[model samples]
Target: MEITEVSITPLEESRLKAYVNITFDEVFVIHGLRVIQGNHGMFVSMPARRLPDGSYKDIAHPITNAFRLKIQQVVLDAYKEIISENTLEKTEDQKQENVAVQ
Candidate 1:
């Protein structure tokens, strides 16, 4: 019932902020969760599949709002950490590039 692990991968595309994978109690794992920047700000999207009728269906989702919020908070925190790490790496790379140019 507790979240044991969370992994986030930042992306460069628009709207989509990152991809998330979470493990519960180190036994249950869910993949393909998304961190998205929506009109209302950041939110988590559950894993979904395209239905044959041209509609999308969630493959996995929490039944309760409280549970969903918990998952979202964990995933967003991980996403923020990844974003900061990526920013630091990019800054370092830019510094190296500047040195080379000098």
Candidate 2:
């Protein structure tokens, strides 16, 4: 998928809003993230939290070198696999004279 547009808006006294391109012509808005420090020797994790006022929170864990590399590899592999599959599907569709309407 191609990322055609992106927007980040910081709300006054509130969380930020992020808009991302879903597909070539599709877009989506993102809820802001809430980051927090973890226990045990600076251990970090992305976890859900309940605020003191009974509100939900999205806690983003800190990124370590190992974790970052792992995540990058995972994302790369998934994207490569998806692209290969999409290319093969497109080829097959062309062979079968099947055209998708945009």
Candidate 3:
């Protein structure tokens, strides 16, 4: 299945960077995926549920390592694009403020 779309909601104030939803073939969609900041930098976390035993179990995940890597790459790349755009916007705003002050 081809990934048809990816939607992201960026977050602040925590290691949880964003929430993501990905659509496959423009029909099947998966929600609650996450972009997380970890010791290794950033990675994608599949949707999971907390079990009664206090451990987490993935609710939806790719079965093969290759597919898992594909999902990770797609999610992380989208997250990075969002961050880059936000950074550019903030830089533009700063420049406008500086010009107003001058």
Candidate 4:
């Protein structure tokens, strides 16, 4: 299965960075994945649901470690690209402000 598309929406809260939606083979879609900042760094959290027992369970996940890693890598790559774009924009804005002040 090929990941046809990925959409990331950035957030501004602690730990949680963004929400992710991925499409597979241009036919299947999965939502509610999260990009989180942990102690080590950023990682992807799979979509999940709250069970009746008050615990959360993954709504969908890869069965194999390899597949899980592949998903994480793809999502993380997209997330990094977005973050870099935002950072570049912010840097440019700062430069413009400095020029204005000068």
Task: Enumerate residue pairs that collide in model 1.
Answer: none
Tens digit of per-residue lDDT, candidate 2, span 2-79? 333333222223221111112123563223322212342211122358999998665543246775444334433444
Q: For each candidate, what is the lDDT?
A: 0.94, 0.39, 0.95, 0.95
Residue 16 miss distance in model 4 (angstroms): 0.5
Q: Looking at model 4, report the run of 10 residues with the lowest lDDT sum.
A: 62-71
Clashing pairs in 3: none
**lDDT score, candidate 4:** 0.95
Give the per-residue lDDT of model 3 (tens digit) for 14-86.
7999999999999999999999999989999999999999999999999999999999999999999999999
Rank order by lDDT, top first? 3, 4, 1, 2
Q: In candidate 2, what residue range of length 10 has the lowest lDDT sum?
A: 14-23
The residue-level lDDT of candidate 4 at 65 comes to: 92
Lowest lDDT sum, 10 consecutive residues, model 3, at 11-20
lDDT of 1 by residue, 1-102 (tens): 999999888888899988889999999999999999999999999999999999999999999999999999889988888888889999999999999999
- Could you tally the backbone clashes for each prediction? 0, 0, 0, 0
Q: Which regions in candidate 1 have their CA more than 4 angstroms from the true location?
A: none
* RMSD (CA, Å), each prediction: 1.2, 15.3, 0.9, 1.2
